[model samples]
Target chain A: MLMIIRLMIAAMFILTTPWSGLAEVQDESALDIQVREIAKTLRCTVCQTENIWESGAPLAQQMRGVVRDRLKLGHSPEDIKEYFLSRYGDYIMMQPPAHGVNWLLWLGPFILLLGGGLLLYKEVIGWVRRTPANPTAPPPPLDEQARQRLERELES
Target chain B: MNKGTQLTLVLVLLGLFYLFYEGLWGNPRHIPTVLIGTDAPMVEGPDVETGEIISLEQFKGKVVLLNFWASWCYECKVEHESVLELHRLFKDNPNFVMLGVNYQDKLPDAQQYLKEYGTTFAHMRDLKGQLAIDYGVYGVPETFVIDQQGKIRYKYVGPVTGHMYTKITQEIIAPLLKGQPVSTAS
Candidate 1:
């Protein structure tokens, strides 16, 4: 009877235990989500073109750790980005801030496109003006001898 | 095309060529650092050989030259001798302290490298690379010169040899040691 009671108690304990620990292992915390969001914005300085989140470089991993730590400490994403910017300059950011000389980098291509389009448009219009249209005069009233030869060839 | 249009096209082509040349041939290592003139981050790490904690905080009010190096980096190997020489030159001064930062290298390998190359200064191990990140270091052999007031006055991201060696010793570190302001001209 004691063995049966012990077995029943074990069964009850197993049934009553919460699965929250398993869930915690599977799910990322809110702080982790914040770290991911911030890490995705930073460039891996040691890497050619990878963001810190996607890079497997040790530096990138440390940077992700930094983001997680800062997020845990209540630093906002903007503050974190500013911190990296202050450290590594504009190069650390995946997107260069639109300021000063960076504005030229941002807008130079569009300005070039507009100017090139205008120049091409003007040149095309000039070509149209300079190019002579097809001669519209009636074909010299096709010579009578040529007309008779054409008709004879058609009949043959 | 009209004169104005032709001239504009020529200028645009010239600008594009200049940009292309710069994009292809420019020195990629010359990344401008924002840490210049900013307060140096107080960092600490373990001594590579001794495992004792070495904190930059204790070196406050002294000129600290932090050289980040790794055993595997070729440039670090190239600059090792010059680095030791620089330390020797300034080590006599009570206010000057030079610390080598062992970055992203294995313990045995780092110690072996030191044993092979020889070292005159204490090297702190950046175990998790947090100390390097604190100083905004990305590559090996990067060096920083901190002023007496704890502000980072200069940073160089390559081997310290030849002109760079002379420039750092005479121009940057000497002037700062003398309590004169150094130019931020990289």
Candidate 2:
């Protein structure tokens, strides 16, 4: 009877141990997913091309981990991103800050468009001014020979 | 058209072309460095094990692979083996060095991590992360390849893998050893 009991316990331990490993693996991958999600929103300081999640840089990876740990600790994503911004400055962010010097990064394109529109307007006005007013009267009809030559040129 | 108008039109067209060129061909992959080719920043902190004060200048005259990592970083764990491999690969190569900077980690946690992972290189704690700021480190696991001349030659912003290991050996290390300019991908 004792031997049978020992066998049952051993079986139970074996079954349960694998579950622990599975749980750990699940937790780890869950963490990875969360980190990736957060990293996707944060810019990579080094690459300047993609967010930290998309970047292959070790630093970006590390930052992803930082985000994950912060999430685990219950810090809001905004706070975590803000923490990094405070430390590394707006240049580290893929999206420039909305205030201060980076206000230009946000508003520069619109400003450029306005300037371009003004320039276009000025050029069009200048061209209209320089162009001789369209002749009020139509030109005389060309002779048959001239018309034939023009037709030939068009055909060729 | 007036000369000024014509000139302005040409200039605007040229600017558009330049913008397109930058969008397509600029060094998008290159991480902007506030510290490229600059001397290693001043870092003073306790060594990972000994609690001895360590500074960046101490690693002068050697090629340093300064890695920023944290215990909480998952990718750091993923690339931990690669770091160990690098440490082993260059164990006897005194000219090459690997240093870890524990970014914003508590001492006990950092110690537990070293114990768990097996420390292959000396690490310094970046208590205030001023070192990371100085190095322009935006994220963890950023590796800087400093040449023997003490100038930072390359910066890898992500995980170091077997393929990257081979590439580093061929493109960065071999060329530097041959006294040639480092061929950067950017």
Candidate 3:
């Protein structure tokens, strides 16, 4: 009976230790996933065309780690992003900020759209104003000098 | 119109034209990039050789140079020399560390490429693309320079050469080494 009890206790410890270790590893991996999600939105400065998440560049990888560390330290996502922005400038963001000098990056297209709409409106109004109301009104007689000039131009 | 009035009008028009030109051609200096100075994202993956789990947190308090690359990317291959150079330069500098993230390439291919290039830097295989996504990587050959404080200080988006290395070192690394706050702009 004593031997059986000791054997059972040893078995339990052996089984539970690995399980606990596995759980801790899983937790760490989960935290990594969370950090990765936040890093994906940032652009890599070295490869301006690629985001930090996609590039295999060394710097991107380091920055991803840095972001993770900051997250672990209890910094909010926004704080992490702002911290990078202050050091690297707007080029580091995949999407440029809308404030300060970068507002144009966000608003330039809308401004162009409005300007285009206004120009189209003006053109349509000018066309309407130039059109005569009555289609069948006899055409105003041309002055003799104007008629002569038109005839000469057409002939040439 | 009098000459003075004509001159004034001309000057105003010129000024307006200049403003538009600047708007089109000039990006504002020191406009903060969204990711600049931000905390780096956590990235973890299997070690390229050992298949052991590697986490970014392991290298805390060291200046890290994270490089993203691939076996098939031509620009990455072009920049490989500079990467090797940087490694050689900083190999003895305990405060500096460089990590290579293999983006979307087979493990064998990446290992072979690195072998051919003679790189001694440590690398992680981001086989499932999870690590890459965390860094917001759009393509390979991007680099991020993180300071000892773990803030991302510099980013280089394309193939880097010797000239780029010098410029970045002078503008970013040298300042940090001297205990001065780095200027974020070129």
Candidate 4:
């Protein structure tokens, strides 16, 4: 009867004990965070626009696995990225490489904005220089007869 | 604008137009392979049916034809017969080897696929998809041909049928087997 009672107490304790599984899941390791960070940078080659982190395609999943495996093997994130780049070229990068003609893509918008701003500034300054000191030109210093006619008209 | 500035502007406009043209019309699927002149990845995996290990290392100094396929892929089903035919045409060549890589597939289903489709070559299981990633595979139905020196010479994505079959056999594999430099279009 004592042994049975001890066994029942053990079962209750076991049932009440919390499993660490939930905590384990909630606490994503540094490696997992690194994997997510790297995955976000890689373009899912099969998918047109989605990055590997956002893509549900099998290839994207496989790429993630590759990233994890490489990480475990002591390859740095840059090395892993370089490996992908060597295999798939610049297309594998979410933002294409900034070498060769691709520099234009990076600088094009700012260049256009600066150019447009300069053009507008030049036009505004030119208009300012071309305009007379007073916009109304002081009525050309109204001739005496013209002034008298304007006075008579006003009186009438 | 001065002459130099006008010329620069025209050139810039042309460049922009070219980029737009490439972005809108070029085939996104056609990623210019960086693997084609590089050393083929020395990959190893289990034989899908027999559970035996197979490695690219064992087939050193031979023309290796690696095909990546999955059971769920339809294009693989499309190229099944031609794959067998390609194997048959070149199997007698002592320097030629054909290997199929079962990617992202269950063992039983992959086995069933081989049985259903009729396989003439040994197929290896990609355990964790490392092999596929090592080969830089984007999707299934990709074929790669490695020269005797273990350099990947050609890679093609999609079903290896129709004109592709002829091209592989005649232009790619035939030349490689003869130790002639591959001068034809890949």
Predicted structure with the largest TM-score when compared to the true one: 1
What overall lDDT goes with each candidate model?
0.87, 0.75, 0.74, 0.87
Tens-digit lDDT track for model 4 on A1-156?
999999999998777665565566655587899899999999887776788999999889889988998998899999999999987888788887899877876777666666656656766888999988878655558889999999999999
Q: Is candidate 1 or candidate 4 better by TM-score?
A: 1
Kindly provide the TM-score obtained by chain B of candidate 1 when compared with the true chain B.
0.91
Identify the candidate with maximal DockQ.
1
Off by over 4 Å in 1: A1-16, A26-29, A126-132, A135-156, B1-6, B9-28
Query: Interface RMSD of every candidate?
Result: 3.3, 6.3, 8.9, 3.6
Supply the TM-score of chain A against the true chain A for every candidate structure. Answer: 0.63, 0.62, 0.61, 0.56
lDDT accuracy of residue B177 in candidate 3:
59
What RMSD, rounded to one decimal, does every model reach?
6.7, 13.7, 10.5, 8.2
Candidate 1 local lDDT, A88-113, one digit each (tens): 88878877799987676577677778
Tens digit per residue, CA lDDT, model 1, B1-186: 679877978698568657645533554357778889899999899999899999999999999999999999999999998999999899999999999999999999999999999998899999888888888887888999999899999999999999999999999999999999887767
- CAPRI quality band, candidate 2: incorrect
Give the higher-TM-score candidate: 2 or 3: 3
TM-score of each: 0.83, 0.51, 0.55, 0.74
* Candidate 2: tens digits of C-alpha lDDT, residues B1-186: 577875776686566656545533454334355456666665677787888988777777777788899998887888898888878877677677778999878889999998998877899988665577667775677888888777878777767877887776678766665567885552
The digit string of per-residue lDDT tens for model 4 on B115-169 reads: 9888888999998878987888888889999999999999999999999998899
